[model samples]
Every structure is written in C-alpha cells, then in structure tokens.
Target: MLGARAWLGRVLLLPRAGEETRMAQSPAPIPCQPTTCSSSMGHKDWMDKCVCLLTAFSEHMRRVPVALPEMVHAFSAQQQTLKQIVICGDRQAKDTKALVRCVHSVYIPNKVLILADGDPLSFLSCQLPFLSTLRRLEDQATAYVCENQACSMPITDPCELRKLLHP
Candidate 1:
C-alpha cells in the first residue's frame, strides 16, 4: 500500500503547469494509505483500486473555494494545452471500469474530467449542461467521450474508447 506522501509525490511529478499552485491552494491530499483488499486479489487489482480511491479523493480536494480566483488563474494558464475530456459511463458496468482504466492510463486527470457514474446521464447532465441530451442508450454499459464540450457518438466497446482517447 502506498503512503499519502508517495501518492501525492507521484501526482506532483506529472507535467501539469499550475498543478503545484493548485495543490498549494487546495486542501492537503488525503492522508489515508491504501489498505490491502482480499488476499485472492492480485497486486494489479489492489493497485488499481488504490488509484481509483486516490483519484476520487483528489477530486474532492479540488472542491475547496478558498483560493478560487488563484486556482482559476492557474488553471486558465494551462487551459489551452489541456483537453477537457469528459468520460461518462455506468458505474456498475464492467465496461465502465475498463473505460476508466483506459482513460487513466492515457490521460492525466489534470487534462481530463473523467466522470463515471451508474447513472451517467443524470450525473453528466448536472455537471455538463451541454450533455443534457446524452443517455445510456440501453441497459448495456456504454461510454461517451466529450472533448472540450463536443461529444462523440456513444461508445459501447472499451477498445473504441481507448482509440478515441489516444487518437
């Protein structure tokens, strides 16, 4: 299990321009360490779970508005370079996990707002008003990639998500 310092250090090492400023202005990183899961789970599984938890925690930390203006200034400085990739998927679906792992592997959280929820349509509609028309499109798991507010066709295959994110 990685310590908070180690996880924060790794996040800091990423090539985000004003990330340091944002981190300074935001609340401290979550102090919790990754706890071991079931013994049957592989190391990769444990690590993935840890990463997801940390990502969620970091997102929560960013909600503080104490230094909103400064944070916005810092974020705007890098806005042109960062692509706001909003990924939406059903949180309970197996394919949603796959899509999340794919996005995390390729894009930095600083560059993308990856939003995954069991009710993605409701979640995204509230977060991104432009996606009010977006829907799950069936019971099966699906993913939608919206770059800078322009959404692509809903994707049902994880491989297609990888291609869309990387390409």
Candidate 2:
C-alpha cells in the first residue's frame, strides 16, 4: 500500500516537458512606440481612437491577473519608441499598488503622468486629507496632474484626450 501511494505521488509530481516549456515561455504583444500620438489624423478621429485605446487598456488591466507583464511584453514586442506615456487617474492613492506594478513593467523613457479626475480644487481641499503625501508619492513619476482627482491636463480641454490620441 505504501509503495502504491509513493508511486501515485511521483506520478502526480512529474512535470511534463512540453507543459514546463510552455509555462516558461511568455507571450509577445503587438508593440507600439512609447507614447507617440498616431499622427496624420484628425482631432475627432484621434479622440475616438484614444477613447477606444484607453478603454481597452483599462479593461485589460482590470481583468488580467498578470496585466502589467503582458502590457510590457506587448510594448517591448512592438519596440514602441515612446517619448512618454500619461496615465490619467482619480488620484485616490488607493491605486498606488497598481501604479507601482506599472512602474515595474515599463521602463520610464521620458515621462509618465498620473492625472486626477474631476475638479482639482474641491478634491484637494475637501476629500484628500493626505494631499501632500499623495503628491509626494507621485513625485516618483514625471508629473502628477490633479484636477478633482481626475486628469487636469491631457483631457482637461474636454477634447484634448481625443485630439492627443488621434490627431
């Protein structure tokens, strides 16, 4: 009985060569330049694309277990020559872990902005008690734009998000 149990354990513990190889290998993603806006495009068209791209990226990051690695692999595969990539956020400091994950995955080439949402003044004054702490945490990045916990710059002008992405 003991011999049989030992045999069973060995069989269960054995790693298939093919499975091991596959597990060791990572998937490559379609890479693009770091943060170059797709040029020769109109503002309306650009905005549309930007929204779509951002939405897709956000969704993927939210869902995938190893989202950062996949994003990095994709970016590297594309050899994306980026000047910078801005990440617009609500600036709760709650998402700092996710931000750190992003930092680990991508090599910060130029700048990465973690922008806040909504109106900056109220969020800074009323809600965020550790505003200075939040800013300091973001000091690790290229810049941290605050606007009501939303992005103050990139999408500030309403259409800039769209324009920057497409046009």
Candidate 3:
C-alpha cells in the first residue's frame, strides 16, 4: 500500500507542513471534488478512499449532504441479497443490492459519473445505509455496485429496472 503521507499529499495537494499547528490551522481539505484522486493517489488509493469515504458517508447519513435515510432504510430491510448496481442521478447509484446481485449496467447522469466507468470506487463513499449495507456484503468474491444507497441487480438493460423491482 502507498504511504499515508503520499496518499494525503496527493489528496490534499497542499505542500507538507513543517508544524502540527500548520496542519491544524489548515482548513479541512474540501471533500475531493471532481474525483481527481484517480490521477494523484493512483488507482488503488483512489478506489480505497472512494470506498472508505462512501462507506463513512453511508454510515453517517444524517451528517452528510444530499443523503436519503429513508431510501437507505428500505434497501436494508429487503431480505434479498444483491450483486450488481445501476447508477442514475447524483444520488441514484448509492445502492448495494445491485452490486451483490451482479448488476450488468448502470444509468448514470453526467453530473455524478466520476470513475472511468461512472461508478463509485469504494463502498465507503456511500452516504446512504442501503448502499452501505450492500457494500458491506461485497468482498473480493462477490461483485457489487453502488452510489448512495438505491441498488438492484439481475438486470440486463439500463432502462429495464422495472423488471428487477416492483417500484
């Protein structure tokens, strides 16, 4: 794994500080907007941070911006396990069930599509618990996809969500 300093540097971009005071005085690094971590932190760190951040956001939905708790709760309540994901709006892809269900395609808006495939790099980046719960189920062995918490899978067409769920 890359060193934290390198990772932090790449993420923050500001020069290293000579003192702890400087570190504290520095403004909280704005959430890495534009998802530039791909270029600086390299692919692994970028993906890890994405998952970690999304996961944290999902776990703490009330504190994060643009998160939907009800959606997350509903997703978690489902007894079915998911494998794939399909992202739509800025907060659309935040579902975990899709990833677990091995969803084949995602319909993402231009605004939220960040990674090379318009998918969140990590499950931790999820701000919604539904997505977070699904992500928590994901591992090297299972395929998963998400954005915020709304997730479903067993789909072949981007416009075929109607086939997957009763919504």
Identify the leading candidate in terms of lDDT.
Answer: 1
Candidates' TM-scores? 0.45, 0.22, 0.23
lDDT of 2 by residue, 23-99 (tens): 23322121122112221111234334434444466555555534355355434433433332333344554443454
Candidate numbers, best lDDT first, in rank order: 1, 2, 3
- Model 2, global lDDT: 0.35
- List residue ranges in candidate 3 displaced over 4 A: 1-9, 13-34, 39-42, 63-167
In candidate 3, position 68 carries an lDDT of 43
Please estimate how well model 1 matches the true structure, expressed as its whole-model Cα lDDT.
0.49
Q: Provide the overall lDDT of each model, using Cα atoms, as 2-decimal numbers.
A: 0.49, 0.35, 0.34
lDDT of 1 by residue, 54-158 (tens): 445545546675434433433342333334444455665676677677777785433545554545356545544554455555655566765434667887777
| Root-mean-square deviation of every model | 14.9, 18.3, 14.7
Candidate 2 lands at a TM-score of: 0.22
Those runs of model 2 whose alpha carbons end farther than 4 Å from true positions after fitting are: 1-21, 25-78, 87-155
**How many clashing pairs per prediction, in order?**
2, 18, 37
